[model samples]
Target chain A: MSLFGRQSKRDLHSLAAPYALDALEPHERARFEKHLRTCDRCTAEVRALSEDAVRLAWSTAAPAPLAMRDRVLAAVRNTPQEASPLGAAPPRPHHLPAHVWGTEPPPPRRRAPRMRPLFAPLATATAAAALVVASLFAVQATRTQDQLDTARAQSREIANILAAPDARATNERDARGRGIGVIASAKEGRAIVTLSGLGDLPSGRVHQLWLMRPDVQPRSLGLFQGDTPLVTSGMNDDATSLAVTVEPNGGSAQPTSQPIAQLALKSVGFGE
Target chain B: MEADELLVRVAGGDQKAFEELYGLVSGPVFGLVRRVVRDPAQSEEVAQEVLLELWRSAGRFDPGRGSALSWILTLAHRRAVDRVRSARAATEREQREGMRAHHPAFDQVAEEVEAGLEREWVRHCLERLTSLQRQSVTLAYYDGYTYREVAEQLSLPLGTVKTRMRDGLTRLRECLGGVA
Candidate 1:
């Protein structure tokens, strides 16, 4: 945002009310804000009026669609934030490619195998490390630097979730043998998924993730291009498992196909 | 944790802090946007933009400047108004208003019990303002109208509408301030 606007020399004090209510037009707002910098009394009044405006805002509280949480969080994870003048920079550690999968293997604390099989040969693996200094949730190792650069803010998030005390991993393999690793933190109500050995998708199809709750409709986490690590948040208490479905292009609001892989979270039905 | 504390963490790029913050603020942000923008789809889009902006600009938040909730709502309201002012959105909004006149809007579901009480409290506070003051504030705020437009809508003098808005908001601040 531009810190300074074209300074208005004349008395624009009467504009304060219209300004606070956002009744002023753009140029008018700039002049008032500019004038406000010099006038402490006006600033004090605007601040008080704005607090009332917040109350007006609160009076109309509406629940955003429940699904929006995951979308926004997913977006937040990848989106780079602007610098804060007051903030000390948070450490952002890169997950070196070699640290993923095989090196310094995290003890697999394999939980109950909640499986829905099209065919019966089930396989399971869990990566429950002391912390995620090494891999399993490697969006970095698998994606291009451009993709990784975009997710600079998220690299730290992926690390934090993986290292969370409640963090534990569960693995599932698709029909084509692509492995999807989900490391979830029940305490944080978030998850990071790493897809490795992904096969090419048909032109119109994409992979979509869902939080499969027992009685309610599944919540779509987001669509994935199948190359990067996926991070999703706002997992409520009832969501029993994570499911992946093949969806048509922009992705369906609801899962359109049978889940290629379903792995129960470490919740009630997931008896160890 | 307080919104300021959470915002500090968010500025430092903490996703979990951002999550808790989102839970607290999304309702007001989305509701206020919908109040001005009218269409649910467009409102959602605008709300998302505002939330993303909060992330991108978290570092710019100054605790001394204002409360986090006020700062966020101000940003949301400004964005919603900007959308309505755009030529295309302004034209589309007129059509929607005309259509809405014939077919009344479907009632939006009331949210949680806690939020209901807050709304009731604010409603009670709003009742304390004079009718003209309340009309001026609501017309400009909820309708996303400029002072000129509000004056036209209320058929009052511009100066009169401006004074009413200021008085209404001042009274509203003290009344709501007691509870908050």
Candidate 2:
């Protein structure tokens, strides 16, 4: 009995158990999800079977090593609770080049295209070339539109964070009183670090952000390029300060250089 | 506070609630990952990831969909399965081809070692399944093998494996009702 033999609802229904278990092949999973959008029966079955699986999960419960509890609680203290609306967009892939912001130069034109006019009648070839150029422009236009959409979605995420009631911003300045950086943190532990006036670095170096809590070593949040704002979801709630240091590219396991600047966070709004 | 209520507080950025929720679910979450990954160190890492994710995404949890424990365990299971599947794909492929030729039939002795009443009930329910059904369910659920891999391991047709799993889970669901 081939599972895919029929396109009927009953055929898709049989997949509920496997689907809930994450056992379906990617393609089959996709198909079932499309069906699941409308099939309440399958949805109910999956929910029920999932409860049963959870029971089986509980039956195997053994105490996690004691150390895990400490680590998990410490992490929770540092992590932000995400607002539901912010999760609507699928997470953007990390480590994407800055070109996703549409800043990269367009590819150079092929030299062969310039030479094509010599062999064909100049007028006819020019007309055909114009058509090709128009098509290429359309493709580039589509790609640029996609980049714009992504930027807009990202901007919305930033706006949502900033608009949070508990949001607080602090400016960090260099020795000459020049504001070099800003850190915005919320009660939820979400932080956005934005930098300015730090001229571009030579190759093999990047700016890294660290969260410094009393009685704990600074933890590296991640590295960022250009002057774009860096969003960190796990800024420690107890972190007294945020700092930026220059590190070898791809970032170091720890801050290897003195921080160029640091922002001391003050408890604001609600009583601490 | 209950797990669900604590999760609600966690969503409101209550660190104390988040800590409580972790204390509540971490054991079951770790045990489930340990069962599938069978590596204490890696399982701990995966369990940590799941708990942190739960904290970060607490707002996304809808109590109407399922209990907090179920949702957390499901997430842990998926992450653990993903880790083991990618890590063992090549080795599992080779072993799966000759698995039936050399592997002994599913052992009953292993099932008897579960001492608690809950585990005993699970074993009893699992025993009621046909041997093939039991094997299919255990491989797919506990071992974290995909149905295709389960079929390969058992040297059975994919359709038969799928049918058996669906039937086995349906039976388990009925037998463990109220008690579960």
Candidate 3:
């Protein structure tokens, strides 16, 4: 049975309204967020709304002062941009690979701004503010680094799955055109598929994914919509291959619509 | 410079960064608060407080989650809302009309306005909303009032206000060509 309530669905539109404005009550906010995990339609809708709201800042803008710019520049001179990878001394030139060429260290420089004693308080505020900013930078730098690491890990996993010894490739098509897909072991099986622009879905509908082999009918992994990134579960040893289809909200038990994305593995070492 | 970059510089104890950031965002921040709070002097004070808070809390900003502009506006919006709501029951709200706050910080926002990237998409979307829809969204968002408060302020039926807000935002999302 569907987990959603009728009032919930009716409230869906209203719920989205505050979310669009970022005015949702805490409880209502949590409820909508949980709903967002499954409701891609609402997710897409909310994003559009947020962007719309952001534009308001433009309509009501006033120019900042010239002195403020000078203040920012002067204050900026006090902070470290980033810790130098190489300390103090300049690096001796070396004949190395392309990646190493630009990594050399330069001369040490202290570019602190010259100031009046009376402006010490301002300088202190500047220093304190810079420290706050540095800490913020560190936090953001870590997050960016983490995101890069995650992307690299996911890429490596996909590469390993596709390059396995038992890998097989197949070409299949539904209403959409044919494309190549590879599956290694159904146990180790993973596929990476890409499609250009697809037609838009209606308000309540979503595109669902399916896995199919020769023996059993197509089984669903979950629902996906538009061009969002989707990762499927690791196939069981018994399962053979995969196919994809666009279906309504919760997806269907069987193939109710034509597949938009499909793939079959090449015979490398084993089929059993 | 971008808001994120300014925020980063500010976080590193750059008073110039704070000043720049204050200059850059203060107008919208102050204007937004002014629109909601409706007191020039109080709005400027709030803007200064907001800038100081930004300086203190610069470390908490996550650029990946939202834009620098959005982050500052969110802070401004929250403070404005809090200020008005708390002051709602007090007689001081009436006395605020004549007192105008003159902020040196406003020069920064005004300077940026000359070379700012206007979000035309939002402008167009907002224009499409009905007058009532626009009023409700502005009051609720800029002021931080509850839906009940919004209804009371407009003297409209609560259900009608809710529906208008919902429909208005929905159309806005559509007009803007999608959500975030």
Candidate 4:
């Protein structure tokens, strides 16, 4: 579907050029990105268009000021290079379908002819068991590695957002005067909610964050547990306030209880 | 070494390769940033950030995707556009209205930058596109206007601008492919 409505395949394909040129709006760009992952034709078209755009970019080549060379080179000297290529690859989707690990049992292996030595079958059985155990360990290791990579990438994104010149934070208090801190960047469309001074919730309940905009329905940002800061992105640009509510675990489609804390967001100059 | 090879070495902490890569890309990066950012000082600053990011994220460069030049330029453009948008967003309403009135002058500056044989060829290709297509592509790519802004500027519908840009770029790509 198009960002605003259903789009025909041709309409989606037409987005490749604008997408490559970085001309689409944020929401439209996002929708086209989702479409790009599954559409080979559009993907190839975008790649080709991007290469052309680079040429177009090069056509505007005015010499950079001579002073920049020394500064950049000096900075490079002071910086340490990456130790590995772990986070270089785009994060692969980690979810695996349940059916991938087929439910049916393998057919029993046919018995070797009577002439075959008994020890051979016994050795094969032992090797098979060993292989199965090894494979299981390998899968577990890979899953752990994927999770580590994801966490590392996320931490990097959070750090960048926090470092943004426009990043702003506000401390909010509930009716009971508990603190909830919020850090947000409107340009980046990201926010981090930090729960502080709020005691642990009882079982079967969670804290859900909502973005309230003038004349717009409150939209759920996310649900979180524990006191750690939760990072959220793709926030509505017009949201003027943030709120937290107690909801049933797994989060409600809509708020079911009064907000525990609320904070009005003040616009801060970003990218200064 | 090629840009990709230099990037790999840079990833492995080769300062020499990093310096060489900087020499290769810094001009185009600065130029691209200047197109979108307008202010030379701010463009230079943004270019520095983009180059620094390239050094820091060299290991993440996936050669299988595209050439190193395209990737770096893409990043430069993104940073430049972000700077422009954020700066505009911060200005008061009257100031933004004033900016909208004068935004078309930026396109003239873009046109004036086209020099040399290579640029002349590009200009030729660009001119070959219909006026609407040219305006849409130039405003979006060079002036850093979003499709919505382009539509609004041209007094055309959003869908019309999208189609024009796509068709325009497709033709430009085909033309450049032949020349390259």
- Candidate number achieving the greatest lDDT relative to the actual structure: 1
Accuracy of chain B in candidate 1 (TM-score): 0.83
Candidate 4, residues B89-178, lDDT tens digits: the string is: 545454656754432354522565448676787888888889998898888888888888889999999789988988888788877766
Clash pairs, model 1 backbone: none
Candidate achieving higher TM-score, 2 or 3? 2
What Cα-based lDDT does every candidate model obtain? Answer: 0.67, 0.63, 0.51, 0.66
User: Which residues of candidate 3, in runs, are more than 4 Å off?
Assistant: A1-13, A19-47, A63-272, B91-127, B152-160, B173-180
List DockQ, one per candidate, in order.
Answer: 0.41, 0.33, 0.12, 0.25
Docking class of 1: acceptable
Candidate 2 or 4, higher lDDT? 4
lDDT of 2 at B142: 79
Worst 10 residues of 4 chain A by lDDT: A111-120
lDDT of 3 by residue, A1-272 (tens): 25577666767656665665556654676687778778878766666566555555545555433333332332233223333222122232221111111122222222111111111111112222222222222322334556545534544444454334333322243445333223233445554333323567777777666665567777776665344334454655555545666666777888887766655432311236
The best candidate in terms of DockQ:
1
Instruction: Show where candidate 1 strays beyond 4 Å.
Output: A1-11, A84-272, B87-89, B92-115
* Model 1 local distance difference test score: 0.67
In model 2, the Cα lDDT at residue A183 comes to: 27
Native-to-model Cα distance after best TM-score fit, residue A232 in candidate 3, in Å = 71
Deviating ranges (above 4 Å) for candidate 4: A1-11, A81-272, B92-109
